[model samples]
Target: MSQDHDEALVRMVNQIAANLGPGREEADAAEGVCTHLEKFWARAMKRRIVACLDAPDGGLAPLARRGVERLAERQAD
Candidate 1:
């Protein structure tokens, strides 16, 4: 992905994490992010995020990473 696209992706994920982080357990927040993304984001968007998970500097927050992982695991099932 282009640098701009990568940054935008990171920013979007971070925003989701932040929105869901308040007054919730970390695990719950992560799951919430996963559900939100799964329900709202396009399938291609989810695939792009999953593909970026291993990038050395993908710029995903910890919660975002967890959310993406959950999304991937669910997709695998």
Candidate 2:
């Protein structure tokens, strides 16, 4: 279960990086993609955290918190 969770996170991060594009630049498309990803990720993360609030799996609370922390950290960067 832990492995599955880790893999899911990796997949999401990989997809985000892939969408970031060829290189870091000031191009409109790249900027738009970055902004879109940030906004979408933030909203999704917020929703997920709320949904996970009462999850039965006790171990998931910390993991969810970590995920949200990581998401926020990435957004800050």
Candidate 3:
């Protein structure tokens, strides 16, 4: 994906995480973000976001990163 696309994906996941983070435990928020991604995001989008995990400065927030990690695990299974 292009850098712009990657950045957009990062922003999107970060937004999702932020929206889900408030009023919830860390694990629950992460799970919610992961579930949203799994259920709503396209396969290509999910793969791209998960690839961001490897970028040194992917710009993903803590919750977003955790959520993406969970999504990756699900994809693996």
Candidate 4:
């Protein structure tokens, strides 16, 4: 994906993490974000975001990173 697309995915991941993170434990919040991505995001979107996990400057928030990690694991399964 282009840099712009990757950046957009990073922003969206961060926003989703923020939206799902409040009033919950970190792990739970991450799980919520993961679930949202799995259920709502397109396969290509998920793949791109998961790829961001490996990017040196993906810019995903900590929670977003965790959620992406979870999503990656689920995807691999």
Cα RMSD, model 1: 1.2
Q: Estimate each model's TM-score.
A: 0.91, 0.33, 0.97, 0.96
Candidate 1 residue lDDT tens string, 1-77: 67687678778988999899889999999999999999999887888888788799899999999998999899899
Which lDDT values do the candidates have, in the order given? 0.89, 0.45, 0.96, 0.94
- The residue-by-residue lDDT of candidate 2 on 1-77, one tens digit each, is 35465445445544544555445553543444435445776565444433443445523333333444444455557
| Candidate 4 TM-score over all chains jointly | 0.96
Q: How high is the lDDT of residue 60 in model 4?
A: 92
What's the lDDT for candidate 3? Answer: 0.96
User: What's model 4's lDDT at 73?
Assistant: 99
Q: After best superposition, candidate 3 residue 48: deviation in angstroms? A: 0.3
Q: How many backbone clashes can be found in candidate 3?
A: 0
lDDT of 2: 0.45
Sort the candidates on lDDT, descending order.
Answer: 3, 4, 1, 2
Best by TM-score: 3
Candidate RMSDs in Å, in order, are 1.2, 9.4, 0.5, 0.7
What ranking emerges by TM-score with the best candidate at the front? 3, 4, 1, 2
Q: Tens digits of per-residue lDDT for model 3 on 1-77? A: 79999999999999999999999999999999999999999999999999999999999999999999999999999
| Least well predicted 10-residue stretch by lDDT in candidate 4 | 51-60
